[model samples]
Target: MNKQKYWLPVLGIFVALIGCITINTPIKAADTIHENYVQKIKAKKELVMGTSPDFPPYEFVKNIHGKSTVVGLDVEVGQEIASDLGVKLVVERMDFDSLLVALETGKVDMVISGMNNTPQRAKSVSFSKNYYQSGQDLLIRQADIHRYHNYRSLSNRTIGAQTGSIQYSLVKQQAKKAKLKGMDKDNDLILALQTHKIDALAVDTATAKAFIQNTNGLIRIPSGFKTSSAGSAVAFPKGANSLVQVANQSITKIRKNDLINKVYLPKVSKYMTNHKSKKDRQKANSMWAYKDFFLAGIGYTLMISALSVCLGLLLGIFLSLMRLSKNSWAKKIAGAYIEFVRGTPLMVQLLFIYFGLGIVVNIPALLSGIIAVSLNSAAYVAEVIRSGINSINVGQKEAARSLGMSRQLTMRYVIFPQAIQNIWPALGNEFISLIKESSIVSVIGVKDLIYQSRLVQADTYRGVMPLVITMILYFIITFSLSRSMKYFERKMGHSND
Candidate 1:
């Protein structure tokens, strides 16, 4: 009877505690679940906006006081939004196609590029009210303006549009009779049109006008295609209702004040006009004027390559040792990793590291690029190392063991040195490849040669010259690296002799 009384009270207390938790837990969770996207921004005191700087008038690089700054209509919109939210605006430059991904991955709080709210994109992200509505236009060579009047006029000719853009889909769906060519950047499409590769380049009215004004030998025409109301809006991650609300308020204020039409557009036009003046245009178009851009690009490219090579070498050694180990698990793991990394494309890997992994932890773009490059280089270097080690006669290891050297000592003192000597040339080739391939990091806005060249192209509106300069710079870097590698190979050869 006494035991029953004690146990009954204890059981009752336990039940009471459980009931309390069940009742209060949901309330606490609900409280915590209150949307705080705006709060987070306020706490951080900065609104990070992602954009592609190549699209002039919307977002483009400008050389102000010897500093390359991202300035345009989209930037002004982002600034307005940030100002309303009581935070500073921070811009993250990336490829236009990458802007949405960056927003989805939390790399940026919102994407304010010239992004239109389409049914397809709306499904993936929440967009604020339309800030700017622009009509579609076709840019053609000055001489071909009469040749192409509208989308229908280019029936059999090739029309170029930016890949992943609304214009790209517009051309595909409406101008079905025309051959559709897609490039990543509008500048490239303009170059294609100038070179006669594409007859017309479909772009926004503002972008087409900006290009025609700044770029020589290009003229704009109306793209008379039936389309729904398409307007640029700020994009936020899905279910970011709080952010969308604030962005809408800011956009509403902007429209109410006629800021976009009267202020922003005029300012953007002034920037474009300043670049188009005869003296300034001549100065800006000169390759020598962009020496700093190229030099900066080379510096960043070398930094990334050098760091990646060193880190990859260390990681490759570890992975190679693991693959060559006696333990089955280690060998299997190392083998699987090498195979997986080697099998995938480097661009995919770079995106994965930057955006995919970014969800778990925020990583800066440059660091992400270096990490991706190093991990990729490790896989290739691992293979080269394994081959070098395997090619060394079994006699060397056996002889080292006979001399009372432990297995680890044999690898450290005898096996590795000879393997490195044998692998020097292969390693040199890998190093050279690293230098060339590091250019891919520019896609993430790493400020490498390619990214800098794109900035120069945007700033100068002279696409081919920047490309030519970049190509020459890359050649110089690689040729120097190759010669240095050869000199080292010769020295190593002498040592072996």
Candidate 2:
């Protein structure tokens, strides 16, 4: 009695310790520690730069004569800032909206995404010197250019901008002001303009030129646009003053060297080809990454998803049987695994095993993703097995037991085969879910269909073609699975009849 009491308190303390450790650990939230982190970059000797590639003439990664290179004013300025501070540049590329989040996380040393310092972001990150400011404008076809008399001419016209850009913000404000239809995303913009889905677009002159060059048959209307009073600057997390001073001085150094004209201009301007008009170059950026390429990705997704579901089914049946066993510890272990996997977000689970596990253990990324997906799938699968086993009229198990059949013999010879045929269609549904969810694996570079489509879009800067192809591929794979499931369902029914 005394020993059991003593160990109970020790076990309680151990449990409390684990809870405290988990609670104290940092999560995906922004890095407030460096919120005032301006001083850290200067002292750290390692500068992390965050930029969104959609902004051109400012920050963009271009495929120059076959080699991909980051070019534009922001790149030129960011490199100088790192060199001046006696630190090396570690540039991080992400979506426009995510750039600020990176800064908020302190994952970035500074953000130079042609970002205008707004009061919202100011709460989290500090600002350095303003290098350049830009105003929004429109570039449209000459024949159709006259339609824009003012912001009102843009009304009812479809407009496009990269999500999270000041350009998008300005367009959204103008769309409300003039009652225009505005869409977010540079890719969406190119598609709208090329397909005549939008009458005109409202964006900056520089971004307009780059997008127009990226696609054919689209022009920027020279009239009917709003302006951006906002100015672009280097962003540091709040409370970082010393880093601000160092970065500001670096900008002053680079501007004087004429780096803007010499290096940045020629590199980006190479993509600025002369085109006749949008109609004449209709197929300009129309095709990329063969339709069959995504078909292969779809095939890969289906393959992994099918294998994972098969693995989950077997694991689920075994775990459920163990949960029904006489051993309390075995039941507890199975229950905990199911609860833990189901309680967490699938995305976090994928990242935890694929990326986080990489730090302590090394494994192929695809297998990591498979394990994450399988863990989550197994939880639901446990319930499915329990229900399937239950649906088999209890009299069947009773009669078998009465016939002198052992428990294991009855389960193997009688229960499983019928339960599987009955639940076969539901298993098909699980497989479909796994395939759709496989898109999350792309975050760890599995090169699944969705990731490949995005890479093609970024490289070519064409929005419509890659996505259109991807959709078709997904449809083909899912439709094929549905047909196969129904075929099996009918076969099962025929056997029963």
Candidate 3:
């Protein structure tokens, strides 16, 4: 009886604990399942889709009635999803490698840039069901098609693929014997193949076909590597199950209705057809046809440089004063900031502002670029101004103080006037450098000269011409600025006389 009583109580306690866990498990899971992504989209009524518009048939920029617009099969799908959800579809363009970062940073609501779903990517973001399936293929010159039958024949040859793409990983793994060249843009990779820098280019079947049809002297061959049906899919932030569920429903409808093959592909074919006409090709190939692209680039470049100069100058003066202050803490803080910014690269700073600081607030790309460039310029400008201040003779400061002037007045009236004359050339050089360095803002999708040149290259399929024009335009801008600075320098010298 004693043994039964003791054992019965222990068993009862164990049973009660198990019952509690069983009862609460479903409630915990239910609490975790939230639809914040869908709720946010609904509240805003805008579904932002991020894509890299270099992949033809999937996504690319097209000159539609004099305006450059993103149009392709992927865009159609994104539109369908937006329509079904009763929201407006807004497209944001950037580099392929930047898509995920854009999505994660909430800079975009989702990404659908011909992105393939892989195990590696799944850990970072959620993916809808495969919307379209495609096979891998190699693009080779027609003259060498017989020499290369498959991936094996390309051993010891240079193969090219888009950086951070599935094709890049595919080439790296299967074509281990082949030297791999990775480029960020498809237009560049195609140029590399034409110029014989790379023997073959690994791309999706659709993309290869699009290129072959539009450009002469290129043919596609089988890649001869096994691939799964995990082809192109829409990516969402992790735990965005609501968005994923809705996207999957849209994808299923698309597949069942044969929309991709019948509707989307045919529509894309029409765009490709229009793009490849002899008259259109001739006009587009001419650099003169893209004068507007260059002009817009120049405008944005000048704007970013101008704004950064004004903001940086004011902030630089403040920081320089802080560094020269007698307060140890202020000096130390300002010194540390300058050293840290100067030590790191402008590219890193741009990304951090666009993607890192972006987590707290949704910043537009152009504004982010401006903020980053302004902040970066402030540090260099601060140092330059500090050196100018230090270079002034201590006798001047003492003389002004002895005349019953406060330190602030001494700096403003006595030291500053001389320092300005001394630092004129240096300040001018800093401004000139700012104009060129502001080009780095293009990486974040600001329509600076560099970014616009890439777009022209993509649309024209002529790489070298766009680069040549961009270089010339940059030279003209910087040279003009240099001459203007010299004019001011001379005026200052005459004033000093």
RMSD of 3: 11.8
Q: How accurate locally, in lDDT, is each candidate?
A: 0.86, 0.67, 0.87
Clashes of each: 0, 16, 0
How far does residue 59 in candidate 3 sit from its true spot (Å)? 0.2
- Candidate 3, superposed: residue stretches over 4 Å from native: 1-32, 275-277
Strongest candidate by lDDT? 3
lDDT for predicted candidate 2 compared with the true structure: 0.67
Model 3, position 491: C-alpha lDDT score: 93
Error of 2 at 425 (Å): 3.5
Residue 244, model 3: Cα distance from true site in angstroms: 1.4
lDDT of 3 by residue, 82-165 (tens): 988999999998989989988876789899999999999998788999999999999999999789999899999999999989
Residue 1 local lDDT, model 3: 30
Candidate 3 at 137: error in angstroms? 1.4
The better-scoring model by TM-score among 1 and 2 is 1
lDDT of 1 by residue, 88-206 (tens): 99998888888887876678999988988899998767888999999999998889867889999988899999988899989999998999999888888888888899999999999
**Candidate 3, after superposition: displacement of residue 280 in Å?**
3.6
Give per-model TM-scores: 0.91, 0.68, 0.90
Candidate 1 Cα RMSD (Å): 10.2
